[model samples]
Target: MLRKITSLLLVGLLLVGLLAGCGAKPEEPQTEEPAKEEALKIAMVTDVGGVNDKSFNQSAWEGLQKAENELGVKPGYQESKQEADYSSNLELLTDAGNDLVWGIGFLMGSQVEQAAKDYPEQKFAIIDNYYENPSENLLGITFKEQEASFLVGYIAGKMTKTNKVGFIGGMDFAVIHRFDYGFKAGVKHANPDAEILSQYAGAFDKPAIGRSIAESMYAKDADIIFHAAGDTGNGMIEVAKEKGKYAIGVDKDQNPDAPENVITSAVKRVDNAIYNVAKDLKEGNFKGGTNITYGLAEGGVDIAPSSDKLVPKEILDEVAKLKEQIIAGEIKVPANKEEFEAMK
Candidate 1:
């Protein structure tokens, strides 16, 4: 009886051990996954021209898109319907925790600066404007508009069948002055006898006014018109297409806008500038309280590609030569009427 009880107890113990073995396997070492880094957030506040102005605002937005696509950034923008929306749009982006906020035009200079001060920890950038005493967190970017404008003006000077061209500006600010005087200089250099008709629409978004101004110029025998207006310039290009004249687009390659009517564009690489800034921030090399200027030498501005069907090869060759001279500092393009008069 004693042997039987001991054998039963041993059997029971073995069964319990087996049950414990079958119940659950020992847990394997857990390897936790590394946490993913959050994407960099960058955004911009467009001027009154909005994001699809097909000019300045459009170029900047394209840059942001590129940063998003190439660098894996979170890109965004708020279009301003009018000047009044600048502050609100910028503040909204800032509050949303954008790593960087860009103001697309000079008109928002004061607002950008104020926002930079109001949010001292936030980073800010503005285009086409700079301050004498910028906040430590603010960056100002300007472009050498005259250099690119001069190249296209040369094209118009050579291509004009009527020996007369026109210039339409959104405003008479210093920025527009660069386009105005540079074009005048190029036309003067290319065709001394060529006459230029100039006008200002007083607004960047008034396409109707731009159309009317273009009509007056074209009616006055101006065969080619170059406009530095924003959306307003789109109207001028439309008129060129209808009237069988030529137009030079600005800020971006506008050939797609009017095809044959748009001879070429004076491209100010706002896209490239914006992309560079974003890249700098991504690389931890971005700095504020500094002003950055881009010109032909810095690849900030250039003439858009010329179609052999529109601009002749010789004209392009001449323009290329001028570009080299400008880069080499052999030629000093004037930025305004005062400098234009002083240029030798």
Candidate 2:
């Protein structure tokens, strides 16, 4: 019985030792599951000019794509077929829980305002329009297109052989008015004796109208023409190419399309503006209920570089000096007729 009890005790001690050893074997380090990536959803609604217009809409779209690639965000877009689709398209993006919704042009200002009011919690941005009573969730982006146009106009004025320049506008709205006033201002700045002839197509997408206007301007002895009429500007460039006159492009560098005729383009850098706003939102530094003005100082507007072949080095250097002066508060570019006249 004693031997049996001793054996039982020994067996019990061995079992305890085995159990403790098993417990001490350090739990196999657990592999933690990776954190899931947060999805950032952004969207843009195009103006009536559509996405492929190679102008405003295209710039905005390019910005959205850039955000998607860099920030790992998902972006969706809706092409506006007509004026009536603006509200619906904005609502569609918001309803889908988009982090930001962008309205591409001034034509969608009313739609954006109404939609912003309806969805006060949603973040909204609109280009080329300033809201009077903007919501806290809304941002109005306005560009100093006049400043850029002025630079291009100076180029046209200097390059014109006939001492006559022409301007083709998309519409008679404030935005278009600013472009016209700026171009004329620059022309006068470069050549005080230069004559400027201006016309409006009354439509942003009518190429035929733009072509007809260009023909009329060319016939009137204007050797250089600048167009601010979205795709309609393409028509103007075409006319310049065929007639071997000079043309200034807008929104993007269109010098490549008509390298021989296109002297320069008023680049608005809409893509950079849109991208900056999106980046701010992504970084949690979004500022709202304000009007953001991007101009020559902020790299928001300028003449394109593709015109190196057409513009003389001395002219480009002069433009650079003017750009610096504008940035240093030594010179101011006007946006309206009164300011333009005052500057003149």
Candidate 3:
């Protein structure tokens, strides 16, 4: 009985030791699952000009595409066929739970306004428009269009052999007026003797009307024609090409399509603005309920040097000086007829 007791005690000690050894073994390393990435959803609604219009619509879409490739955003877009489609198009993106939606033109001011009021939970942005009292969720993006137009107008002033230049506008809206005013200022700055004439297409998408108006201007001895008529501007450019005269393109470079005719383009950098806004949202720094104006100083607007013929170095040097002056607040480009007259 004594031997059995001793053996039992020894066995119990061994079992306890084995149990402790088992318990002391380190647990299998547990890996924390990699944190899931947040979704990036950004969308844009095109004005009547569509994504390929190569104007504001195309410019805005380019920005969204850029954000998609560089920022890892899944971008969406809906093209509007007419003015009536703005709200529904905006709703399409918002209904799909997009993080942000953008409207490309000022023509949709009322539509976006109503939509913003109706969908307070959704964030919204509109280009080429300024709202006096925007909703907390709405962003008003207006460019210093005059600043950019001035540069191009100066170019036109220096390059016009006819000593006569023209401007064809779309819709005669405040935005178009701003462009016209800045362009006139630039032309006057460069060549005070140059004659300036302007007319409106009465529609943003009417190319035939633009061509007809441009034809009249050209016949009237206006050799250099600048257009801010969205899709209609394309027709104006075609007229310039047909006449073998010069055309200053808008929004984006038209040199790729008509290098021979397109002397230069007044670029709005809509793509950059749109992309930056999306980037801000992704970085958690989007500023809403404010009017953000990007001008020559901000690299938001300028004349594209995408032509077959190079600008004279003297002309370029002069333009650079003017640009510097504008940035330094030594110059203020006008946005209206009254303001332009005051500049004189």
The C-alpha TM-scores of every prediction are: 0.94, 0.91, 0.90
lDDT of 3 at 267: 89
> All models: lDDT?
0.92, 0.89, 0.90
lDDT of 2 by residue, 95-148 (tens): 989999999999899999888899999999999999887999999999999889
lDDT of 3 at 133: 90
* TM-score, candidate number 3: 0.90
What TM-score should be assigned to candidate 1?
0.94
Quote model 2's TM-score.
0.91
lDDT of 2 at 161: 89
Looking at candidate 2, the ten consecutive residues that score lowest on lDDT are 325-334
Clashes of each: 0, 0, 0
lDDT of 3 by residue, 1-344 (tens): 99999999999999999999988968899999999897698888898988899799998988988999999999889999998898899988889998898888999988887888999988899999899999988898988889989998999999999999999999878999989999999999989999998998888888999899999999999989999999998999999889998899998987776788888888899999999999999998888888899988898998886743656778878888999999999999999999999999
Give a tens-digit lDDT track for model 1, residues 1-344: 99999999999999999999999879999999999988899999998988999999999999999999999999999989989999999999999999999999988889999999999999999989968888789999999999999999988989888999999999889999999999999998898899999999999998999899999999999999999999998999999989988899999989898887998889999999999999999998876988999999999999986545589999999998999999999989999988999973
Candidate 1 clashing pairs, residues 3+ apart or interchain: none
